[model samples]
Target: MAIKKKRQPKTLAAGRPPVFHPRPKSISRKSTKSLINQHHLLEKRKRQAIAKGDKAAETAIEAEIEELGGIERYQQASLQGQRHDRGGDSSKTLMEWFKPCFAEGQAAPDRPLRMLEVGALSTQNVCSKSGHFEIERIDLNSQEEGILQQDFMARPLPRDDTERFDVISLSLVLNFVPDPRERGNMLLRTTQFLCGPERHSSTWSLRDFFPSLFLVLPAPCVANSRYMDEDRLIAIMESLGYAKAASKTTHRLVYYLWRRESKCLGPESPFPKKEIRSGSSRNNFAVVLG
Candidate 1:
């Protein structure tokens, strides 16, 4: 009889799991108690590592915590808690607040008022159906037809001052700028696109109110929202020669319509003679969008 073939055992390497794999859905569905305990344990270990001056251990622990989905889960829970804490309908749209401003300008429709919507690529139809205003849409990162792919912060104003719009909409744009100073720059740049401060000789009429800014921003205290508060925002606008025409709030956003003051009464007014500078280095109060 032939000798039996030698039997071989499977090697561990042959049975090894895949090196790269997607995280399991079970991790996301983990029980609240389990998630909390895991977070606490990681925090305790991190603290211990810090106390022992083990930088490598601390970094590794941090990475482990992140990989375990601890941080993301906590952030989601915190946001939910915040929403429940602030009891108001969070589903309201920016257009609702903008409608009143639009309605006010309807009385003088002899000329089609110009309106510029910055960051309009995402929300294309905001003014598409409106007969009261002609809209010019501009955006920084969209390839869709009709969207002007220009960065609002870097581009120069039109050669003809008349090309400036009567109203400009900044729906859900300001919060992107993490710096307060840069946010101010975004507002100042908007003024260049809007009708400038009324000359001393112009008579008061509905047209005086034609050019206003419809702005929407996240609530200052909202979870994971921008750091700037509504009070500070209004203050910044006022300092930049805008007076708040109207304001409203949903659960998470604060919307305001700011009109250019007939005259900037503040000592720091940029409209009197100073050019609104986009470079932060050139001017201390500069608001650069880039």
Candidate 2:
């Protein structure tokens, strides 16, 4: 009985491989070269397709290229007319360029003034083209070197404990913040920071903040149905002690000159409640903070 028990042989289960398994193919220079060649062929095909106006194929190739380089970098590199030269005008220079927009009764200063520009990069070039005054630029993302990096909603400005700036330019930045209250807060903080604690004390009121502040916003901001209406925007500014001295709309852009006066509150609607006083010979509007 013991001798008969040793006669059975081993067998693999049905549909299963044998106990011995093949090792995986290793990545090698030859394989890598083959892959690269395949990629090049695919790219050539894509180019040919694009030349023929085959949109779907072109899109597929673009997607592949984007995957290789990452979408953001690819977009940044390929986009044309992303940057424009504004002739090296600083904010002060641009102020003069826009000075014709100022209404009568606004004050004009004789000296070079400090200006802060938010969300302005190429516009700074335009500003510089005017050759007026020194301007400091702040942006969320800027390719230009030496500009301050900041997100209006997240980062607070540098606290230098001095009311040093004469002009703060916020152009095309407010609408980016989706919330009206937050937008109002950002504007308030900007004014408060520029005006300093001496001017921003709780008891001091709006007049203590500034004699005049200039604000420019896009017309779409007023017409946007997703956020606060123009009336709400005006109310928020007025509640925070800003009065609209003058506002003008051209095409899709709406420009506002807000004044902080000792006695005047802001307007109740998008319409100007008072005539804006033009300063000097320039048409630029001014807000009297005090």
Candidate 3:
């Protein structure tokens, strides 16, 4: 009898995300949920001040962050929050939403798809090992080998369909772009880097199909924002020619898959910062297009 070889399961990545790199011996286990949230809020305020040309406020916030161990320390803390052991890997959910397409035979492994992962935190996530996707990962501050240090806003737009992606993953990225108008512009930019429906056999007509967006936002941005709710978000995406295909919400995050149903916003599309809802406890998070 011939010996049989075992095959590896495709669902899990061959390798796992490593612990935070260059982690100082004295700084081990130094990050907490509250600390991470503080860093996020502080960074957002810094960005807002810089964007508004408020030099004094920007200087003050920079001094405060620097006093609190600087941006590098905050970045390391954020990475700790993303450790696989902490249930911080958002791409796992993206893979779950994608698997059915391959299972149903709509996508083939031989014809591997392309994806752009913005604000990527790891090189060994499940999507990178799927053997069905050629992923291009980028971040503003890349601390790993595979992810490039590049700003998504400054990345050269695809010259043609061959240069565009079948999918785009914008996980936990938009919230960091402090200005609401710029946040809206970033969403508009993704449409340009996506391969349109005509290139694929499946139109964004079906759920979990290619030419789609996997958007992950902090749940509070939708749930507790005075200006935003799930309904308002759906409406904004509609104006940009995408239709919500699926959604899920947890106490910490809100995830959605939006299919590119039509062309994106033109030069003059208008989505202003008008209050749509009111609540005393809500934070101000709005995506404005001007």
Mind giving the per-residue lDDT tens digits that candidate 2 earns over 35-138? 43344455567767977999999888777765654433322331211223211222343354356534355444344545567765554355655554467777
Model 3 segments beyond 4 Å from truth? Answer: 1-31, 51-57, 104-110, 202-208, 267-269
Q: For residue 225, what is the lDDT in candidate 2?
A: 40
Predicted candidate 3 versus true structure: per-residue lDDT over 12-108, tens digit per residue: 4546665567745333444455566677788889888987999999999988888777766766766676676666578888888877776654534
The C-alpha RMSD in Å for every predicted model, in order, reads: 14.7, 21.9, 10.0
- Residue 196 deviation, candidate 3, in Å? 0.2
Better of 2 and 3 by TM-score: 3
> What would the TM-scores of all predictions be?
0.53, 0.48, 0.82
Across 1-290, the per-residue lDDT of candidate 1 in tens digits comes to 89999989989997998788765333222354356457656876887799799999999999988876765564343233223334322213434544554565344444567778776643335366556567777876544577687778987886765688877877656654434455656776777776666521143444435467888655542222233344545666777678887777665567677888744433263322123333333322223221
Q: Which candidate is the best by TM-score?
A: 3
Highest lDDT scorer:
3
Off by over 4 Å in 1: 1-107, 122-124, 197-209, 221-227, 263-290
Cα lDDT for residue 253, candidate 2: 55
Question: What is the lDDT, from 0 to 100, of the residue 121 in candidate 2?
Answer: 57
Quote model 2's TM-score: 0.48
lDDT of 3: 0.80
